[model samples]
Structure formats: structure tokens, C-alpha cells
Target: MSTLEIKDLYASVETKEGRKQILKGANLTVRSGETHAIMGPNGSGKSTLAYTLAGHPKYFVDSGEALLDGEDLLKMTADERAKAGLFLAMQYPVEVPGVSMTNFLRTAKTEIDGKAPAIRTWTKELQDAMTNLRMDKKFASRSVNEGFSGGEKKRAEVLQLELLKPKFAVMDETDSGLDVDALRIVSDGVNRAKENTGLGIMLITHYTRILKYIKPDIVHVFAGGQFVKTGGPELADELEENGYDEYLPEGSKESALA
Candidate 1:
């Protein structure tokens, strides 16, 4: 099985004031077919960890090694990371106004695989994936995530996850803004990807509701820019009942509760 290891990761982002450190010596390991849930309060740097691993330009790695099967992910470019079997489902998926979903998916698939798929087979696979995600056929011809509803955008992200078949996926709050039915559908799509490909996952979120569907094998409490607690599924139930107050600092507790 493949392994993604994050070793003493330190990262930061620039703001008007200055560079603000986010991830401070964060470390974790995820094996193929295992799901790790990262739960934290807002501004706790959970999303920062997700974007940093995906190699987003806005975040800079200060000192760390994100090794995917012994290869350093911090050394690769963003697209290079993807080619190396890493995927990020953004918290807010961006809009690509002129690109058709059909063309985008095929082009991305071709790039990742290093060869274009046969048209007939690729077309069938795309249709089947979309259908399984409960997406409309018309979405294939529409601009990628342009003018789509929140749920539709999320479904489109899962569509890419299913089609691209990444080794590990950092899903950043994918359960956010989803209704009950949509949540179940999206969760099912994720489950299917894991089952089909043994895809490892780092699922970042604030609530345990998504955990009910995704079922994380490990749950981590992120605070003070790093993981403070790690446990099994029972930890999520505990967080749900008690909230992050115990995990937060004195100054941060009120805001977290509010």
C-alpha cells in the first residue's frame, strides 16, 4: 500500500501585516484505504494544511517534508503533485468560465495518465461517474463550476475525484453547504472512490456530521497550528459533545464557541 507522510511540517501565508505562520510542526501519516479526519475551530489552520499539501502558491513551506511513498511532495510543483497521485477538493471550488466540464475532465485525465484515453471508453466512464454522482447530463457541456449551485459545485469536485483516481485526496470541508440529500450523495461518491481505488483521505472539517457518512478511521483535533489530540471515531463523538473549548486557548475559546 502507498503511504503519504507529513513530517514536522511548518508553513505560513502572507497578509497585509506580514507573513503569518500557520502549520507549526504538524505531522501525520496516511496509508492507502485509510481516512483521517482533521477537526478544528475556525482560524486553527486546518485549511492552511490542506492548501499547503496541494502546493498552493499562497502558502509557503518553511520547513517540512511531505513524502508520498518516499518522494518529497514539497519539492514538486502543484501540477507535479497531482501527477504524483495527490488531489485537493477545495473548500470553495473556483469557477473556470470558458472551460467545458467534458473537455476539462478529459484533458486532466490525459495529463495525469500521460496518455489520452480512447474517446468512446472515456465518454462512457464520464457519463457513468456523473450519473452516480446524481449530476445532470447538461453539466457535461456547461462551463466548469460557473453559475452552478453550491451542491452542484461539490458534486463536480467529486466527479473529478472519481475520474482522476488520485492515490490520496485532501478534501477541505466538502460537507459544508450541502443539504442532507446532497450530503449523502457526495459522501457516497467519496466512499465509492475509496472502495474502488483504496484512496487515502485527509478529510478536514469542523463537524462530525460528515464523519457519520465518511467514517474516519482516525480523528485528530487541530489547534494552535498543530494536532493536539488524535484518537479513533469515539474522539469525534467527544468533540461533538464537548466542542473545541477544551482544545482552544483562553483567548480563542470565546470566539470558537461564538
Candidate 2:
């Protein structure tokens, strides 16, 4: 089975004040078919871990190792990482004004697969995925995310996840800004991916509402830039009831916000 493993990962970003460390020796492992929920308050470095794994240029990895089925993910460029079966569904998807959704999705699939999908099959697959996400067929002609609503943008993200069929996905607060119906639609798509492909998931979020829709196999409490606790799905219910108060030290609640 495939595995994405992180060991003592420490990363930083350059700001006006110079380099600021975010992830501090965080570690985790996700095997295919497992969903790991990363729950924390704001600024606790959940996004940092996701971006770092996907090889985002903004973050600098000072130390640690991330391996995807025995391959070094840190050594690969962002596109290379995608080719290696890693996917990141960003919280805020960017708008590509000139790129049609159809072209973008096909191009991405072709690049990652090292081959162009047959026109008929690919077209049918694309339409099927969009329909499953409740997206309009006309969206295929529109420029990516341009003039799209928040729910539409997130649905597009899941569409990519479904069509591309990545080995593992890092969903960074994908539930944010989604209405109840949109949330269920997106969560259903995620569940379908996991069931169909045995796709491993690193789901980053703050609330447990999404947990009800997409049950996690494991729950991790992220705080102070690292995972302070790990447990089964019950941990999520506990967090929902108690919040992060018991995990955060006195006067350190701010650290949980990430």
C-alpha cells in the first residue's frame, strides 16, 4: 500500500519581519485508504504542513523528511510532486481568467499521467465528475474559477481531485465558506474518491461539522506548530464538545489558532 510519511518536519516563511518558523517537528503517516483529520485553531501550522508537502514555493523546509511511498517529496518541484500522486485542495482556489475549465482539467490530467486521455472517454469522465459535484455543464467553457461562487470554486477543487485520481490529498479547510448543501455535496465527492481509489487523505479543518459528513479514521490535535495529541475518531467529538482548552496551556490559547 502507498504511504505518505512526515518526520520531524520544520518549515518557515519569509515575511517583512524575516523568516518565521511555522511547522516545528511535526510528524504523521497516512496510508492508502486512511483519512487523517488535522484539527486545530487558527495559525497552528495546518496549512503550512499542507503547502510544504505539496512543495509550495512560499514555504522553506529547514529540516525533516516527507516521503511518498519511499520517494522524497521535498526534492520534487510542485509539478513533479503532482506527477508523483500528491494533491492539495487549497482553501482559496485562484481564478484563471483565460483558461477554460475543460482545457485546464484535461491538461492537468494529461501532464500527470504522461499521456493524453482519449477525447470521448475524457469528456464523459469530466462531465460525470462535474455532475456528481452538482456543477453545471456550462462551467466547462468558463475560465477557471472566474466569476464562480465560493461553493462553485470548492466543487471545482473536488472535481479536479476526482478526475486526477491522486494517491493522497491534502484538503486544507475545504469546508470553509461552504453552505450546508454545498458542504454535503463536497463531502460526498470526497467520500466517493476514498472509496473508489483507496485515496489517503490529510484533512485539515477547525470545526467538527465536516467530520459528520466525512468521517476520519484518525484525529490529530495540532497545537504550537506540531501535533500534541493523536487518537481515534472520538477525539474529534471531544474537541467539538470541549474545544482546545484542555490541550492548550494556560495563557497559550493563541497558539491553537492555526
Candidate 3:
């Protein structure tokens, strides 16, 4: 079991104005065996929080600390952070032209585990996880995310989640482009991961349909760079029904969190 703590986090992206703040004094905490959901409208800095926690070079943390199991994550590089058991499933997965799925997984496994497992043993586990995610076996030979469908791409992300067994995972809009069937499969995959591994998850999404499939212990409403409300799963249903209007003033969404 592990814990991820983000305290008074202030972050921004490099821009002509020097740094454009995206996350402003945000605070969150997640412990093992719990699933937390963050829901907000567009440009709410949800993805920025994910990238910042994962230590992406493009996103800068101007203030605050991100701790993984009591270790200072801000002091580590991206690969070091991953090795420390932090994983982020990107909203838009990148395609590597020449990286085979099988080989990439093996390399990442080697790096994280500090040694290589027997080929048969590791490959068997990989195949099993892929099967659980309902992915085709042929993808093992294909380049990573190369021309795959949206559902296929999301499944590939979940495959890594299972294979890596990270202490905590930050999923940024993972259900964005998926259709209904794909959404069910993806959410089911998340449920399986939570049940089977006792992993802690922070799911960042804009839709409530997924909350039905993966019931989160806590639901947070993020807007204008910070969280304004935190509630149980019922808040998700309310948001879905009211469409964030009750939470907003006339002709104004910019002040929703301010």
C-alpha cells in the first residue's frame, strides 16, 4: 500500500507570459485501495494535474510538493518517478512509430522491476492481462498505438496499468473518445484493476456515465484551476442531470471555481 499527496500545488505551463498557471493551490490525497474521481469542464486543468504529478517536463510545478509513499516525487526525473511506481494514462496516447508493444512492455518492465523476468513467464502474464482487457493478440506485434482505434488505444493504456502494477495511477480522460461498448469495457478494466490489485486510482473525467461503472469513493468538482466541491458518487449523478448549470451563474462558467 502507498499514498500520493499533493499539497497546495501551484503549477503552470511555459508560455510567452512567462508561465500560465493551470493548477492553483490545488490539494489532493489518495491512498491504496481507493478510487477518487475528478470531474470538471474543459480547460479546468485536470490534465495538467496528471502531467505535473507524473513529472512531465512540459508542465512545471511552481509551488507545492507531490509525494509518492513519503518520497519526494518532485525531486525525481520522469523515468525515476515511473520506477517509483507512478503511472499516468494520457488522454491522448502517443504513437511510437517503431516501438513494438511486446518489446516496449518488456523494456518498461525491465526498467521498473530492475531485472528481466523469464520470457515465458512475463509473456504469459502479458497475454493474460491483454485477454482481460479484451484486446486482440495481434497487437503484441504491432507498433505501439499505431493507427489503432480509440478503444484499442485506451485498452492498451489499461494493459500497461495491469502489467506495471504501479502504486498509484492517474488516468486523464481515458474514456474520452470511447463509444458505449468501449466505455463499458474500459470501466470494467478499471474495476478489475482496483479489485484484483488493490491499486489506488485518480480518474479525471468530464462525463458521469463512467461513474456508474466504476463507483468512486469521492467525487471532486474542479473548475477554474481549483476544486470547488467534493462529494460522494451522488454528486456525479447530479452533475450529469443538471449539466453544471446550477453550479454556474448567468453567462458565466469562468467563475464556477473562482
**TM-score, per-candidate, Cα-based:** 0.98, 0.97, 0.94
Q: Mind giving the per-residue lDDT tens digits that candidate 3 earns over 1-258?
A: 789999889999998878899998888889998989999877778899999989888898888988998999999999999999889999999999899999999999999999997899998999998888889999999999999988899999999988888888899999889988888888888888888878899999988878878889999988777788999998888888777655444556556545
Task: List lDDT for all candidates, in order.
Answer: 0.96, 0.95, 0.88
Mark the regions of model 2 whose C-alpha exceeds 4 Å error after superposition.
Answer: 254-258
Superposed model 3: Cα runs more than 4 Å off: 245-251, 254-258
Q: Which stretches of candidate 1 lie over 4 Å from their true place?
A: 254-258
For lDDT, the strongest prediction is: 1
* Pick by lDDT: 1 or 2, better one: 1
Candidate 2 lDDT, 1-258, residue by residue in tens? 899999999999989999999999999999999999999877788999999999989999999999999999999999999999999999999999999999999999999999999999999999889889999899999999999999999999999999999999999999999999999999999999999999999999999999999999999999878999999999998999988877666667665454
Q: What shift in Å separates residue 216 of candidate 2 from its native position after superposition? A: 0.5
**What is the number of residue pairs that collide in model 1?**
0
Ranking by TM-score: 1, 2, 3
Error of 1 at 30 (Å): 0.3
Candidate 2, pairs of clashing residues: 41-257, 41-258, 42-257, 42-258, 43-257, 43-258, 44-258
Error of 3 at 109 (Å): 0.8
**Candidate 3: Cα lDDT at 202:** 95
